[model samples]
Target chain A: MKKNLKWAAIFGSVLLVCLGVIIFGQFSHGTTSAEIYVDGKLYKVIDDLERQKFQSLRVETEHGYNIICYELGKIWVSESDCANQTCKKYGKASLVGETIICAPHKLVIKIVGTDYDKADVTT
Target chain B: MRNNTTVQKIALIGVLTALSLGIYAVEAQIPVSNIGGIKLGLANVVTLCAMMFAGRLAACCVLGIRIVLAAAFYGTFVSFMFSLVGGVLACAVMCLLIGLFDRKQLWVVSVFGAIAHNTGQLIVAAVISGTGSVLSLAPYLAISAILTGILTGLTAQRLWFSPLKRFRITQTRDGK
Candidate 1:
């Protein structure tokens, strides 16, 4: 029993540490960029949408279409043809590691930054 | 062991299934402002309790039926697929770890089950979204799983030895 508790404690601490790193990474500032992917392919990359101030792109895919709205430092799916409006409800995310996914539409909007390697940070 | 008949086992599984479905509905109404696809998974408590008091097969029966009924009541086909994936993966991990862990370490098993559930859901999300970016949320999902798993695990651990023995669905090994 004591050994079980010890194991639980060890696993719990490891999860906590990983969570802390993710949170810290989320808060830290880095070069502002965003990536949009559809059906596992890169659809668009906004290197300086922050400078563009405001823009909207209507993306059409085999699943459906989504109107991706970009602001100073955030991106979102303003409109979607999916049954559930979860993607639209996600609204906007400006953080370095934030994301909005339209599952029904197979659309992904992710906030990327130059400071971190996207593939390395996540499993 | 005399009370652990087939009829009693079926009734117990049915009751637990209903309870889990009810929990799922109530949890859906609770607004949780967190990352996408994260849930408290309160219904899993019933699954865990069923697994401990009854057996893995009984637990699987309850979980499978509960998820199906719950999805039919308030979820779409896509949502149902996600639930099926998460629920099956979680139960599989929990049942597999039962023999691995000695003592009353149900919590550890529960935590691993939660992690498995989240991983399954994450994979679904990644596939649906068509990007590996959804994997970025893994850490947050892991954290949520740990917290919620501890809650459900402790509840099951307590209920395992509670007065609900009268409804004993499985024969006790040590004749409690």
Candidate 2:
């Protein structure tokens, strides 16, 4: 391979990866809402939670149950009956597209704040 | 002198496999934080070096053994799947590029190989999670691959420049 071409291929691949990240970021931007899913289906969508401020919810699936706590614009799994405490131990999630998954329960909590929902000023 | 012979070749492959496994075990012990699938993958140094010292087939053999042994010793089915795919992809990419450039440019080959490895892992991650959102990590993993690849490639380069050359069989001048 030509030396110049080799260099181009290396830089080109990096550029493509960066572009992909940018596009994904733009599409998933904002964190005004949180979408909860169970077994690949939409479970619930918590929107404009700032009005209520501190909010908590319980999500129970056939596999088990989870207590999700939302406070100060952050979400976390405070309790789960699943054998693996990975979700409970995940701590806090505030970023857009961030997720807390309880695999055993097949439950997923994903941040999906759209631009119109407004960013949480308190955070 | 240990000239090119079937027994010598097989012995070299065995030694390389052992070295790769040793490095892999050590790497597995290091603590990782907020893992987005980033890894040092230092064991790849032996895989790349095997290409330079033995051949493409020998490198594949080394990587295959290392992956199987590692999975049997320290991996779950899920972890084994991830490593098997990543290791196979990385070894294949490196072997493909091994003959394209001289040993001085092994990092180029390694960079592509590492990227391929990460891509493989990312795919497995997405499939296991049953979501494409996990792909958001692609860019981050790619960047990390470049850095780690350079590190492992330079290590292999140094070994090639050292007395390790004496261990190289009298087969291909470029050693494939």
Candidate 3:
């Protein structure tokens, strides 16, 4: 019985450590630009967000809509027409991999740029 | 050992569904975590126990009814989609693991099932949101799956030895 538990504990611990490393790596990689993807396709990129004082980008899709608000260092869903409001509840995030998702509309706001360019700088 | 008469199978599935739905109602009232998809998932105890006592088919019947009924009662279409994916994947994982684990290692099956459930939900969230970055939530979800899985697994294990014996619905080791 003790041996059985030992196996489960070992497997569980290994999984936990692997996941932890991924999360830590994401937070440590900083980016000021945020990209909005509508249904997995890139819609827009807000580059060098620090230069912008405040902005609200409205993304209206066939499924629903979400208003993504961005400022100096962070991005968030300020308002949404989705069912659960999960994106709004997610509040705000500024890290490189951070994302605000409105599932009902399939909208995603992800932090994905660097200090090199205006986060909105998309060619 | 349980009889496999038509009426008996129907009654077994019905009973399992009722018990799980009741458990679901109570669990719904309690919010264990602030995160949207994170919860103790106590109702899953009944589903797991059904798999052990009844059979995989019966357990699936119970789970399917519970998901549909719960959604009809209060859940939105989006929540319904999430539950369907999570519940089905979780059940499938348990069905596969049940054959491999020692009878006493039922907790292992439960833990794996819980993680599969969380993974299923995470995948749907990522797809619906349109980015893989939502995977940033993976580590947190995995950690929760382990803790809650252990608790629910241990609980199911205790019942397997205790009350489930009296309510046993099938003699067949259906998965094996």
Candidate 4:
């Protein structure tokens, strides 16, 4: 049973990857509103027009980290002071599938759309 | 050599707890790569080392203490639970695998631990979000886990072999 579970996990993992790729490929483009949050608080809301300009917006939070959003066409963390910077270099968030995260402050900026809203975000 | 006394054990656990907290704080302060929740997971090195040098029970104690203290320091109990569950499960599985193998495959165990850690966290995230779709991130998390695991495991291996080599040799010799 343990052996079976391991194999199942491997196969399930592969299947999930294929599914994610398919879903990502399918919804890769569209004009959508972008939302940003800092420390679980709503910080910025960018519409399709603002998203196109792809300019930089700096969000100063109560926490020590300063979130710099660059490239309006897609939302990406251009700069951040957090230790990992994993969220800062994510480049830009395009499509409904992308997200930028700063784990220390428990902050997450994701592209939420109707499909994602129905599928995941909403409990 | 004699076994560590209670005070020594407590002091060691305290030191590891502090180390893990320091790593966690430092990780939060610097921005390295922005891949959505990807972290260096430096604390795992200490946890893995504790397992090898001290014992599985000792490692568990250190890991548990570290998670609890770190969570309290951060003031996020919910997320702490996620970390604790994920981290403990991963460490236990890795230790078990390593014990079973009886080989110098620290990197393999590290990778397994990391993947397991991510899997545990993903499970919590999915449950919290009330959607199975969050499972979509599993592959990405797995890839990151494998990379970080190797890095952390290598560090642990060096730390274990360098200063503590004599102690390890003695322990194995005495056992036989």
DockQ winner: 1
Worst 10 residues of 3 chain B by lDDT: B29-38
How close to the true structure is residue B77 of candidate 1, measured as C-alpha lDDT? 73
* TM-score, chain A, candidate 3: 0.71
TM of each candidate vs. truth: 0.83, 0.73, 0.77, 0.65
Give one digit per residue, the lDDT tens place, for model 2 in A5-123.
67658756786877676557546645456778787678898875445477779887887789998876677888887763556666676655456666556677776656733554534
Candidate 3 local distance difference test against the native: 0.78
- The CAPRI category of model 2 is incorrect
The better candidate by TM-score, 3 or 4, is: 3
lDDT of 1 by residue, A91-116 (tens): 66776667777777778887766554
lDDT of 4 by residue, B1-176 (tens): 23534455566666766787788778766655444467779989888877776667777888887787777776465567579779877977887887864435676688789888988887765554344444545556766787788789879888876966443323443443
Q: In angstroms, give how far residue A94 of model 1 lies from its true place.
A: 3.9
**What C-alpha lDDT, on a 0 to 100 scale, does residue A111 get in candidate 4?**
64
In model 3, which regions exceed 4 Å deviation? A31-34, A44-58, A68-78, A89-98, A111-123, B1-9, B25-36, B172-176
Considering only chain B, report the TM-score of model 2.
0.93
Write the candidate numbers in order of decreasing DockQ. 1, 3, 2, 4
Docking class of 1: acceptable
lDDT of 4 at A122: 35
Clashes per candidate (backbone, < 3 Å): 0, 3, 7, 21
Candidate 1 residue-wise lDDT, B1-176, digit = tens: 55546667788898899899989999887655446546778899899878876789999999999888987898777778788999999999999997787537888889899999999988988877767888876776778888888888878777776797456554554376
**How far out, in Å, is residue B108 in model 2?**
1.0
Q: For all candidates, state DockQ relative to the true structure.
A: 0.42, 0.21, 0.34, 0.16
